[model samples]
Target: MEKVVRHRGWQWLVGVWCMLAGHMACAQARTELLHRAQENLTRVIVHDIFSPPVASRIYLYANAAAYETLVLGDSRYVSLHNQANMFPKIDQPAAASHINYELAALYAFLRTGGKLVFSEPMLKDSSEHILAGVGEVDEVIYQNSLRLGEMVSDSILAWSSRDNYAATRKKRRYAYSKEKGKWTPTPPGYIDAVEPYWSQIRPVALDSAAQFKPVPPPAFNTDAASDFMKEVKEVYDVTRKLSKEEILIASFWDCNPFYLNTQGHLNFATKKLSPGGHWMSIAGQATQRAGKSWIETSKVYLLTSIALFDGFISCWDEKYRSQMIRPETVINAYMDEKWRPLLQTPPFPEYTSGHSVISTAAALVLERELGEGFVFDDRTEMPYGLPMRRFASFTAAAEEAAISRLYGGIHYRSAIVNGQKQGRGIGNQVIQKIRLNAGIGK
Candidate 1:
């Protein structure tokens, strides 16, 4: 009788140990899965050469799909199916049975990411590897996860079809302006403006693209003593005296998709992350540091993506509307005919900086989710051969990115300063208006 009792006690201990080990494995898998998803997104963005606005749209829908699907599995979280704009009616998972939340979230993330990115084969292979790592579970649980992921992906894709992405893709040509205060292509290529019709694309959170336009850029003045010329001179003067640290900051946040590298006769293009992509990487880093669960990480990506999408819309609306000239253009025309900006100016209208608007919008959402004054090492640019940058807070990083444009001589101080304000407003709107439930009961 004593031997039998001891044997039973040993069996109980073994079972408990297995359960704990399984839980730990799932936690590790969740972080690995999210990290892989983000990497695939970067790959697709670089290979496909998606401009910033199009990249933001892809991130928004894909992250939202993943978030809505994952939240369904966690009783501690609620779905955003009906809460967001133009959300499709998706089939809900079975509420009666015990579902494996980890597998469900992983499968959903894979499905959503596969749809949004161009590197389909790589993403699919990564998903299969993740599923294998999940090891053996009940066949019903596995099948259910697969089915639910497919449903969520289809729903999100259907809704995205109506967002005018296809229509905008057809608009390849834009009118060129010779007006002194208006934008014209700059340096290298000096090609037609990129995504001139981007403002017409549907915004996820904003009422319209023009919902919050920044104040008009100060009137174009050629007079060297005028405020407008002073703004141009500031950019010129700053470029002349850029410190080594300032140059590093400028290069760190360049985020120019069309950067060209030419040495002698060997010219090749360097593919880098867009502004929105950089913020997405930051979201992934913050979530990993916080030890967030799949549901929590999904929320971070979803909100940050939406902020980028809407922030770009608002910024571009002001850009094309105001038709403001870049500092490089103004400086060359009036100050020094031979002068060029320290950094290559991107081919787009300037008013509110795109980097400023999106970075601050994403920073605010991240701060809200990951505590105020949270510090982290941003290694996102390291893979691009840039050194890691440490930030006291997400806001600090955003502010620095805003100022880097000034130091780079690509934007005036007014555009950088006002762009931060516009971004903060957009971020506040996202935090207050878009409701996500912490618990599933609601």
Candidate 2:
């Protein structure tokens, strides 16, 4: 009888140990829950073929929603509302409430992102799968966490409604100008200019959309000896004479989500990440490489997304303002009518390259958060079929992204150089203005 009693006691201990171990494993995987949610958002953005500028807006709101949720009930983190404008005060968890903050973060992210994009079903399916896994473990915690998530998501969605996005949607299409310097549609799709009133949308960090506008692009000049013409000639010559490495560099960074391919009588679009999406991938890689905690990871994403958002606003404000002509239009009309750029020219005005401004802004934020001299191999394009590329540092990667525009035959040299300056300026602004609470994030 004593031996049987001892055997029963050992069995109970083993059962309890297994249960505790399982809970721990789920807890650890929750960090990855954030990454999975991020990946889902990235995929949806790509599939939906959002223009680069619009994609930046989507990233900003989603991650901002996530970070705000993360800060709730955790004194280690701080809400952006405390640092920047446009945020409403979010109520903390009730004193007796039981909530899993990370799950709440994912919920807010998916909910906000779904509201912004057209393909809600795609994102909704993924969200359900993630939540179902939590449900199996502990129905009570899952219910509580989701309730917290919904509350946080509701506040953010409400804030987003007032950002003038819908008002911009009702605005007229971009009207073209016959003047030589002004922008017009490109070949293939010739889609209307994307988000022309994006400047009018409320900024998350900037005082206004024009806060860090670049200097006006060089005046329209075609004389061979003119500075403006020289930059145009440089783009023409470099793209036509691109070496294998240069071609690779251009192709690697060709994050044009609007790229259209044509066959005999048939044209199809090849959807890919925008330049800002690629930077988001890099931010994720850096966090994983350094083994950052879930909270730390959310902070990195939130700041980087903010930089991308403001950079686009600053870049686009100049793009439409200068209304500079694209290289393809110039080279084909004057230099070679039969010539086609190595990459498709996006449908928008050219001046301050969007790639340069956003890349530099994102890199600067990452550099400050990840520290200088941080190294990582970018596999962001791998899913799009490009091999991974290594970078010695964040700024180095940003420089390459800026120059890729010239090699891709999309922007003039001045656009690339000045865009870098513009982006760096925006980055400095974001890094200075938006900071972690108590300086816990490093």
lDDT of 2 at 260: 88
lDDT of each: 0.79, 0.82
How does each model score on TM-score? Answer: 0.90, 0.92
Number of the top candidate by TM-score? 2
The candidate maximizing lDDT is: 2
| Candidate 2 residue-wise lDDT, 259-337, digit = tens | 8888978989889889999999999989988878777888999999999988888888888888888888888787888
| lDDT score, candidate 1 | 0.79
What shift in Å separates residue 27 of candidate 2 from its native position after superposition?
4.9
Error of 1 at 76 (Å): 2.9
Clashing pairs in 1: none
